[model samples]
Target: MIQVVLLGSGNVATHLYQAFQKTSEVEVIQVFTRNQSLDFPSTIQVHSYNQLIPADVYIISVTDLAIAEVSKSIPFENQLVVHTSGTSALDVLDTKNRRGVFYPLQTFSKVKKVDFSEIPLCLETEFEEDYAIIEKMALSISKVVQSVSSDQRKALHVAAVFSCNFVNHLYQIGSEICEENNIPFSILFPLIKETAAKIETLTPIEAQTGPAIRRDEKTISKHLDFLQDKNQKEIYQLLTQSIQNVKKL
Candidate 1:
């Protein structure tokens, strides 16, 4: 059995805490947090840094900013140390001679339900033996574990910002446009879903259907007049022109 001490009781930490408890092969030996929590069963007490006990692994599921400082606080005897951060590296865990990165790519929120099996874990470490331990720990929770190097993981993270974070911001803009037009955002739900569905089977260039790609000047003129904000008009114009220049346009 793999005994573990979980540091930080945030969203990711909470998910790992509950899920790991459910697995027969893993046991949560202790939970460490600065504040008291009623969510955990009373039998399983919360702990401070000094109260942390011996375990096979110490998983720090804290925020990116607090990781290095928290690493310094932990008094483990150079046991396996891993952090659940995407951008942060193995070097953040300064305490141990052995360190690794256990980054779950999927976003975590307390009320949101997530399937652990579908979550892709990016694992990395300086020491090869420590890498194996973190890899097993990741596989215990997820089937989609990838042993990615630090550089590749960083590149994937940059791409994720454009896909996930930037796309979410665009969704917010679309919702705002609907609000200004006195139309419910739900009307665009089907279109939004269809756009995502198309990309699975077809290349983005093939699935590209827009006034810009069609070079329908009449529709483009109408859209430009309808756009009240200069910023929105410019973005729409730029994207449309890019589509028009493509050979497939």
Candidate 2:
């Protein structure tokens, strides 16, 4: 079994710490947290950096801004250290010679239980031995483990932000529009789900349906008139133009 130390207690840390503990292949020896909001299993020891104990490997799960400094604070030189971040490069852990990245490409929330089986693991390393060890650990938690270079990982992060984060913002706007028209927002739930479900079998362009796709100026004008908020109206016009561009491609 691999003996590991976990750093941070935020969304990514909470989810990964719990998931790694479930498997017999890894033993999480220590969990570090700045705030004591969470409770670790009795088998594990929790600490702040001053109280931190050395382990075979230190898994840094803190925010992007803190990963570098936190890794520097830990007093381990020979021990391998890996940080979990989608956008941050492997060099962020450069405070230690034995450094790598074990980024899980999935959004994590503290209250939500993430399914590690489906989450893709993006691993990168500066050392050969460290790379092999992380590949094994990542494969233990997920079936999809790819040795993505920093450049490839950067591109994936950008794509993910546009695909997931931006789309969620669009959902927020849709909810607001529904509220303004005195329509129950829940009424859009089915359509939202169906839009996602269809993408599994159909390309987004194939699934596209709207006045914009058909380039019906009359319907597009009607939608523009229906939107009351300036922001919503701008968004609708921009998205419609984007859809039209996609169709032309």
Measured by lDDT, the strongest candidate is 2
In model 2, the runs with Cα more than 4 Å from the true position are 42-45
- In terms of TM-score, which candidate is strongest? 2
Per-residue lDDT tens digits for candidate 1, residues 1-98, read: 88888888889888887677667778887878777766465555567687777888888888899999888888765677888887887787885546
TM-scores for all predictions: 0.87, 0.93
For residue 165, model 1's alpha carbon misses the true position, in angstroms, by 1.0
Clashing pairs in 2: none
Model 2 scores worst on lDDT over the 10 consecutive residues at 37-46
lDDT of 2: 0.83
As for model 2, its CA RMSD to the true structure in angstroms is 1.8
Positional deviation of 144 in candidate 2, in angstroms? 1.7
